[model samples]
Target: MTQEEEKKKQRTRNLVVGGILFALVILFYLITVVKMTGTGA
Candidate 1:
């Protein structure tokens, strides 16, 4: 409930969200590559 604790919590949340977004981007990139190569069929 302290200011420092709040900042730490916010930073952790931001990192987790950023990581999820990054993983989704990589997943989409891989899917696109597979589809373009006609290997997904």
Candidate 2:
């Protein structure tokens, strides 16, 4: 593949992985916050 094609593929993969990681990080933060608060939310 050409450089452009390779870059496009890498960009797509980065977006997908980044989205998953963002979601997991949000979930982790929320869980920790709830645990610390003991709000049982």
Candidate 3:
């Protein structure tokens, strides 16, 4: 593929990975908050 196409693909991959990482972080934070609250949220 061309250099520009390769860069675009890399950017897309990075965005997807970043999104998943953010989601995991949010899930972890929520789990911790629920545990602290003791409501089993």
* Each prediction's number of clashing residue pairs: 0, 0, 0
Better of 1 and 3 by lDDT: 1
Query: Candidate 1 vs candidate 3: which has greater TM-score?
Result: 1
lDDT of 3 by residue, 1-41 (tens): 99999999999999999999999999999999999999994
lDDT of 1 by residue, 1-41 (tens): 99999999999999999999999999999999999999998
What TM-score does candidate 2 get on C-alpha atoms? 0.67
Candidate closest to the true structure, highest lDDT: 1
Q: Which candidate number would show the highest TM-score if scored against the true structure? A: 1
Q: What are the lDDT scores of the predictions, listed in order?
A: 0.99, 0.97, 0.97
Q: What C-alpha lDDT, on a 0 to 100 scale, does residue 11 get in candidate 2? A: 100
- Stretches of candidate 2 above 4 Å error? none
Candidate 2 residue pairs in clash (backbone atoms < 3 Å)? none
Off by over 4 Å in 1: none
Q: For residues 1-41, what per-residue lDDT tens digits would candidate 2 score against the true structure?
A: 99999999999999999999999999999999999999975
